[model samples]
Target: MKLKRARRSRRGRIEIIPMIDVMFFLLATYLLASLSMQRLDALPIALPDGKTAPLPSAAPLTLSIDRQDHIEVGGHAVALADVGNAVRQQLHDDRKVIVAADDKATQGTVTRAMLAAQNAGARALLIVIRHEG
Candidate 1:
């Protein structure tokens, strides 16, 4: 006598739960990797230290000077002669300005930029320096 065999049934539907988990893991991994690769926009420099003070409520204008003595007002490059005018245009009622100078930059260049900020009617001037480690 021949025995009869039963065939198992199979479902063709796709499983989505595992795929969603894998996608989430990949997204998290990429996010972490991207964060590690982020960089600061300001030029690296050694800064002087002083007593910490509260920042003003209004956003202050940023002026940067690189080692090469290149001057930038609010991230836009400007000639030394035009620094004052550029600063003036950005000044509002707050009239605050922040100057960041590279450690290798000459004192003369930094002084000139500070003077320009003053001439532009900056009521408050703040120098940005790296905190001593």
Candidate 2:
């Protein structure tokens, strides 16, 4: 003969708070990672709209033309006349140059900037434009 004994039952549980914390961490990590992966080569300005194209793989020189007609190369202030020289100095082997001009910039200024870069030996002159609707 044996004595009867009481039994205890164990129930598995899922912690919701920890799971939510992990998800938030993952979300923040992905957001930061994506932001880091982007390549920002030029200053922020109002760009015009035009046909779109893929960016070149090689690191290209950025030439920014503000609405006030001020020119900058690789984040450095440069004169309009010195644009060619600046391009020649900063351009890589791919000869890729990105021209970012403001939407309010004069047509002549943009044209001259493009020509200056081209004359400086930029084989791939990519003009940055706004995305079409």
* Poorest lDDT segment (10 consecutive residues) of candidate 1: 39-48
Alpha-carbon local distance difference test for all models: 0.84, 0.86
lDDT of 1 by residue, 1-133 (tens): 9877687688788789999999999999999999999845565566676556656676688888888888888878898999999999887777888888887889998998899899989988888866554
The TM-score values for the models, in the order shown, are: 0.66, 0.71
Q: What local lDDT score does residue 62 receive in model 2, on the 0 to 100 scale? A: 86
- Root-mean-square deviation of every model: 5.7, 3.3
Q: Which candidate's TM-score is highest? A: 2
Number of the predicted model whose lDDT against the real structure is largest: 2
Candidate 1: regions farther than 4 A off: 1-44, 49-51, 54-58
Worst 10 residues of 2 by lDDT: 50-59
